[model samples]
Target: MPDRILVPVDGSPLSKRALEVACDEYGTAEITALHVIDPTEPGYSIFGVEYDPSTAPRHGSEAWYERATELADELFEELDALADEHGVSIRTETVVGRPDREIISYATDEDVDQIIVGSHGRGEESRLLLGSVTEAVAFRAPVRVSLIR
Candidate 1:
């Protein structure tokens, strides 16, 4: 088993499953959960919040970042509880950037031995145009990568 494992979380069911696998299978390893906020997709709302241009904060503004941070906090709370259930303690980080790049950079800079990431089953056409984060990380990461779909 890897001594250090990185897990990228996005509050998706597959991401949650990836975390579960990491905690269950690599419980002894040092685990880190990374959440990336893509500034390019400023209109993206993951918490089921309706995106109303009139009411929503301006994209890339301070208020938008604050809202993203708040959402990240909510995600971490749930992840922490899940890790607790598995008797595993994980460090959490939230960064603003593209998910794939951030994940790969973290693994390389932090010297993570392995990465467990979720695959968002995107359709072939969609993937051809914009590859999934899992695909990017798996291809560019220096360490081993395990995918959970």
Candidate 2:
């Protein structure tokens, strides 16, 4: 078992399942839950709410960043509760960038021993366009990676 594990979460069911796997299988390890805010898709909705340009904050604006932060916080809260239920503790982090790049960078920089991430994220169309973040991290990460479907 790894001494440290990294789990990238995006408020998606698959991501939540991945976190559960990490907690269940590697609960004794130090786990860090990472949420990447993709700037390229500023309109990405984490809450499954339809985007309404009429009322939504403008992309790249201060309001948008604040909203993103708020959403990240909400996600962390839910993830924390899940971890608690599993009798595990996790450190949570939020970073702004492409999910794949940021996740790999964080794992390498933080000396994470393993990475557990969802096979698919919330943005299927975007994944089709930009490639799978899970695949990218699995191929590029220096440590071992486990994908939860």
- Writing each residue's lDDT as its tens digit, candidate 1 over 38-136 gives 899855535354667688799888998898888888999999999999999999999888889999999999999999988776665564532377889
Quantify all predictions' global Cα lDDT against the true fold. Answer: 0.86, 0.86
Point to the candidate with the largest TM-score: 1
Per-prediction TM-score: 0.90, 0.89
- Tens digit of lDDT per residue, candidate 2, span 26-99? 99999999988888885753646466778989988888888888888998999999999999999999999998
Candidate 1 regions exceeding 4 Å error are 44-49, 123-131
lDDT of 2: 0.86
Which pairs, if any, clash in model 2?
Answer: none
Deviation from native of the Cα of residue 1 in model 1, angstroms: 1.8
